[model samples]
Target: MQSTVNYLWHTDDLLGQGATASVYKARNKKSGELVAVKVFNTASYLRPHEVQVREFEVLRKLNHQNIVKLFAVEETGGSRQKVLVMEYCSSGSLLSVLESPENAFGLPEEEFLVVLRCVVAGMNHLRENGIVHRDIKPGNIMRLMGEEGQSIYKLTDFGAARELDDDEKFVSVYGTEEYLHPDMYERAVLRKPQQKTFGVTVDLWSIGVTLYHAATGSLPFIPFGGPRRNKEMMYRITTEKPAGAIAGAQRRENGPLEWSYSLPVTCRLSVGLQTQLVPILANILEVEQAKCWGFDQFFAETSDILQRVVVHVFSLSQAVLHHVYIHAHNTIAIFLEAVYEQTQVAPQHQEYLFEGHLCILEPSLSAQHIAHTTTSSPLTLLSTASETPKGLAFRDPAQDIPKFFPKVDLQSDYTTSKVRGGAGGSNHKTPQISQKPARLSQRCHTPNVVVGLCLPIPQPCPFSVLPWRFSSVSGTPEIEEVKRVTELKSRLRALAEALSRCSHRITETQLRLSNLSSELLKNRDQVHADRSIQKIQCCLDKMNLIYKQFKKSKMRPGLGYNEEQIHKLDKVNFSRLAKRLLKVFQEKCVQKYQTSLVTHGMWMREVHETRNHLRMVSCSMAAHNTEAQGVQESLSKILDRLSNQLLQDRAKEAQVSPSPAAPYPSPALTDLVFHMQELCNEMKLLAFDLQDNNRIIEGLNTPPSGS
Candidate 1:
């Protein structure tokens, strides 16, 4: 506290430090809310730099939900001690979340999509505002501690953000080396500024690289080692790392892994995500700037993919999405590679663990019956060249893996699987441990909520073209029953959160009604206004019913449907299910909220019209006051002349007879003076009327005024 830079901000703890400035977690003395302050030691800067000034200007002007907001700049301690107070993200960096091996299962597919969508949205905002977040790395993207939990991520760090006018190309080279586009990377490596110019498209390239790295938990383009030379190293880059290829993309031949050719997309992914995302990465990873898309083009393509359910993967990062498609022609080898990625233990050390049948998930009935369905116990993978986890010195991974469903069940890999519920297993397959319906097993210390098990997914294309049938779960007890029930329990908790937010809105609306009434009273002095209080109350009550359902969820986990109905489901559409659920808990809310939203629109129009009216009245008053002043000035001169004449006449009368009340020379003169008094009184009355009008207009425009 004693060494504080600003009294207005109470600097509590140091958050991070950069090359030029240090960031501190500080509290605003006035608001008492926490903020982050990037304090710069101006002694080194001496004079304000262009880039730094632009950073502040850009931050102050932009207002996007996904981008971090800037509050103000302060130089409290002295002129040289400058600080930029900005919004704080207490949940920390996205890099920390992605890099942690501790997140063994990693982030869920739904969560990963949510993060990507948010980041892209923020980038689009920055692009539209004529700014490029040159540093679009994981370190700059952070999760905010918000009402939506830690799922909301924001893009920050404008230190290297570029502000360009239309048709302007960026000439300066600034940003982290790892995230730089190929052209920028070449320039940095060469240590000499080239005449080549680039646009904000560099940012899109960076984003693509960033996405790939986050998905795989490994960098897509790591610079190879060199003899640390100043200028000569750039020349060496060409000979060192493999360019124009998927460096870490994993591939399995019948014998060994072509590890260098593939990505680390080792995580269990959704059915077709591997194919969907591979081209996206390639589209963004183009080396030639001409072929690459600008901001508008990038948004169009990326948004289309994001709107659909993104490729879901668990256990693996984005690095390996390529492998699934690359080896699709031969499903046998691809199946082996999937196992290698899932184990997190390399293929070499743990081939012995999978002894039973390696079953794909259920395929369509027509595909099942029409295709040759043979049960083979042979799914041997590349036992020698599986990419080992980063830190293992030697030896094999022990058999102590986490408890998982057999038959290569991969629920976590993608957001949703397309495979239908159950298909008959016709092959004389061994009665597998995979066939048993998943039972509820309590983890270390979870609540009464039951855990879910994922059903297996069948291989695609060439694998289907192969003569193999996916092992099925025993038909006596359905897998859908277990999954639907368990999924229902977890989903109820999320629905409860939604209901709570709705209740908060209803309460806020009620408070607004009170304020609105007082505001009308101020404008009219005696007032009445229309309000939809009844409808709001109904919506509130409906929301409570939904919340109550959450409370009783443990006993009645069914979503108001019988087991018989759910069992009949061979295929399910979640969008339709969600609509039905909304119909149940949100009947009144949907109807009333829509009506209120319309009312809100009308209220906005009225408020806008009121402001315009007040402004017009103020202008009209100014013109009227000018006319009044002219009349008053003319009247004053006449009154002054009359008084002077009377005074002179009175002096003459005093000489004849000493008298306090002097007589008028003529009756006509007395009548003229009376007329002057009448005109002055009329002017005074007009002044009072104008004053009252101004007061009313002012009160109407402002917040509810005092009595």
Candidate 2:
């Protein structure tokens, strides 16, 4: 069917083709993200309208990690075409892996089990919602690559799936011949009674077959490819046990799991997996549909797998399943009381059954209720108008409850049959479950099986026996207080690392500010030295001028040849070499003052940068900020003292020489030197105070010992 979808999706090359749809590698135009597009040739479908609509209804309702997500749907009116935009699985389907010649050596058991559990988890969710994927085969299961050498498997191809009402059954068999349940095949192909149909348990049979094939590298049953041979194969599926087919069927190492009456089986499952799996296969592959393990039962029993399939239950209604995993052995009554209080149900009339049937009140005898994954404990509870039931129960063992095997301890003889299997070969079927479905019937209104899984806890069940029943582990418990505490510790360490980064930044800011303040002090001291040099130069100039006057007095009528004047001039005059030294010192002092001014500006820039950063780190860090303020106040006081001293020095200079051109006499020069020395002493004290401030800042910058 040719059509254009929304401008948002850009269709690319075809990825793969299926029976009713063609999958393409596409990109979301808005996000540039890759996605898989399943385009349906609605005109070519067996029940085109029903298939298209049913898939849409089913995908929209389901939301799970193991279930393929349906992002959007598109349809074109003219061409009878429909599109399903979904999450892309790059690695393709499990069927492809099993069939590929490259994987003839077989997949690692670890990788295989992980993928198996993921598929089971998704199937459990499907069963809970009353939906069944009638066609669950290797081809229908897709594998997606995940983080760190892990892979996730999700159930796809819901075209053959449907959600049945409690009274409904899948009488129309529409899947591969090898994967179909015996009951479904008999009714559709053999034209058995239409009323005789199967429930969701059909999917369980397929799961058992799929897992068996994945592990053993061969199907448990012999293939009857043509129409004439199909009848013989169907009979075998109905009568032959899985143990028989596996013992006498075909084998291959690097090809499709081909099995025929003419070949021998090559078992790929490890002993540990075989011990657990063989019994499961024997039970699930049972001819009587009701005798096999239900989907929920399979999930619960497989808990002891290498990759434990943790029970995760989700609900759309307000009904919440709060898990209370108790380690210590306790009375069932305490747990019930706690649940009753938590849900705020009335306290006066509270009657609970520890191990009995659970019934949900309904108008019809065939309406299906929600499915729950129950523990090995056969406990059940009857549903009421209020979902918060008074109690839970276990089935009466005398009648029959499909039993769960104890943890498969496969260290020694895995080939040895399980407890029930070794019980003298009597019909290994649970009579109660085989009787009828767990609907609101007159006789079996509340059966042993619970419909949905919620609040699933494992082993040594606290809700199995009577209110006063105790567990085997009273002192030492089964459940841990907390599993994987190391993960939590790592998160805390990440938080600590973030805090350290913040502290380091603050320390760096404070250090820069301290360095700037120290540099500013050095500049102020350089200015002081420059002023001293200028005062001494002024003294030398005064002496030179007086010496010139003494020499020029020779032309003066009376004072030209006066010995007294010459003697006085010689006593005050400085040597030529000494004068040259003074001139060079003054020039050096000028350069020093100029360099200090530039440095002082740089110090100001550094302070400005610190001020900008301080806004972020300006938390009232108790001791550090307060100490910084104290140092600032001390610096302010020193600046004030220096300002006063400078003003005093200016007054002294004005008083010592009233005229700018007048030379200072001996007494005046001595007074000027003494005053300048006093000013320099005060400036030296300011420098010392700046050094003290630097030390204080250093103490504040040091990190706490504990940190």
Candidate 3:
């Protein structure tokens, strides 16, 4: 029979081909949106109706952002084949992306994080929506590219999806060979023997395999060939050692040359990227499902790594853009050579001023006399003086010379002088000439003097061109004091919160204790009632045995004697029997009397012990009750103190305003208050029940008298 479809869309361009279906790029005429049409071949071994029904049942209920959307399904006319219309992804499958030259065999670490996050997000969506994509691989995932260079990943292939129901059992072995779970492969290998039940963990296993393949561009485990050959692989997967162990074993067997690299791509990544990437990949590809991180956990970790990468890249770009060089020493000196040179003064004058010493040179003074003068007075002069017959003549001197010359104060201009005739003198006359004392100021040349300025350097202004100068002034001490106070306040708040939580937990524990006491009382009552019933049953059995003996005696009749003879014989026998019975009864009475005495003694002892135990329990209960009451009162007082403290802190905080803002109460406080209230209610209920139980127990102990 020829099937008919509405022909909503058609495309001649084949997008991809799977095992049972061929996908084509098409456009929905009504919606005018591009869509992928997946056509199932009717000529395949699978029954068309069964496949369509199964696919429809799963796809109709699935609704998630990550899972592919199924728009419509129809039967085509000529081939009688079922077709699925799905959303068309523009960027195509992840498999194609990984295989592309742009990605270079595998994605870079940063881009890998992005792709991994997408995959995990999709898997998490599927998990949350009670669906497990049994075949989660790069080929089954499509990435849609937006105009802003953003990508959206969608998980496709609903034909392998299954619902997550606790009671439901899945036995069908269907999935790609490369991504099949060990359990599924086991079931397939043992198909003729017995069927095995597997849960959604199989999907996790498959996801692990898919993640391994995605990361390394190769499967973690590979079979030789075919289903029978795959059995050996499954056994290896289930029973053999891990990948690390296998690699180690291979190395041991071949002495390291067996695993040696033949070329550069023998190991796809460099030594460093591999060391970091391999462990991360191993965590996702763990054989144990429970040990492996779930979709959400994986995505959360992956997103964190991605954020770290983004921050790192941003930091690198910032470094490159700013291109600032930092130096420990002052480089500003290179730009201010003129200013620095202006500050440089001669060191000789500085030494003279600081050391309080001077040097002088006179033409007539000898070197020995100059050294002697330096030893006597610190102002030393090295010069030579010419002596005439009557007086000494001096060279040119300034007007202020005489005022500073203390030694020459006695010498006056009217003093007798001697004229020297060293050059040419026709008549040698004794002319007296007075020699002027050397002035202290004439000892040193003042023109060559240098003075060192000791003035402090001017600080840079706020708006100055100095790079290290601050733009605004701050009261640092005040800010620090405020921060310290804030920290103290936060710690106090935390302490109060902790105290409140402890009080709540104590109340809850008290409530639970009271409930347990009540339950213990009820159990004791039931045990007592059951014991009484057992005793009554034993008594009834004894009475039944006595009645059966009486019935047996009444059925016997005299066989061989007259009435008088029988009566006399019966009387004689009765007398003898009465005597023997009396003796036996007396023995029994004595035995019973002894037994009663022992029983009475035991009962008295039991009563005394019970009384003592009850007293001890009462005392203990009283002590415990007192302690609990004290604790409750103490907690109430502590809570009140905390409340008062909190109010005072709030007031103090309000008075001394914060720079930014005061932190608000944590949202956890509301939950704490609610829990505290609930605990108080529960404690009240438990206390009432405990009181009732104590009363019931008291009543059970007090027996009725004169019954």
lDDT of each: 0.46, 0.47, 0.42
- Tell me the tens digit of each residue's lDDT in model 1 across 519-578: 433422211132222333343344333323333342343444454243223113322332
Per-candidate TM-scores read 0.43, 0.40, 0.38
Error of 2 at 190 (Å): 5.4
- Runs off by more than 4 Å, candidate 2: 1-4, 7-12, 44-51, 76-80, 165-168, 187-195, 224-231, 242-266, 306-707
Name the runs in model 1 displaced over 4 angstroms: 2-12, 43-48, 103-107, 223-262, 268-271, 309-707
* Candidate 1 whole-model C-alpha lDDT, 0 to 1: 0.46
Q: Which ten residues in a row have the lowest lDDT in candidate 2?
A: 452-461
| Per-residue alpha-carbon lDDT of candidate 3 for residues 1-707, written as tens digits (9 for 90 to 100) | 12234334444467788777888877655556777788887544365566557677777777766667888887676665778878889888887665442232245444555566677777776666677667777888888876788777788887767776533567777777656666676556545455666666666667665555455444455333323344554445443535432111121221221221111132233232343344445555455555555655665655544342110000010001000111223232321221122212122211111112322222233323222221112321111111111111222112101111122111110010000101001010001001001111111211221100111111111111112111132354323323432343343334334333433443443344344334434433443343333333333334233323323333344223454344334333323432333343235323332343333233223323433444444444344334434434443443344445456756776798665543334232233333333433433333343344333334323322311
Q: Mind giving the per-residue lDDT tens digits that candidate 2 earns over 288-390?
A: 7767766656777665453322111111011122222211233434434433443443322222122233222222222122222332221122222223221
Overall local distance difference test of candidate 2? 0.47
Better of 2 and 3 by TM-score: 2
CA lDDT, candidate 3, residue 518: 47
Best by lDDT: 2
Please name the candidate that would achieve the greatest TM-score relative to the true structure: 1
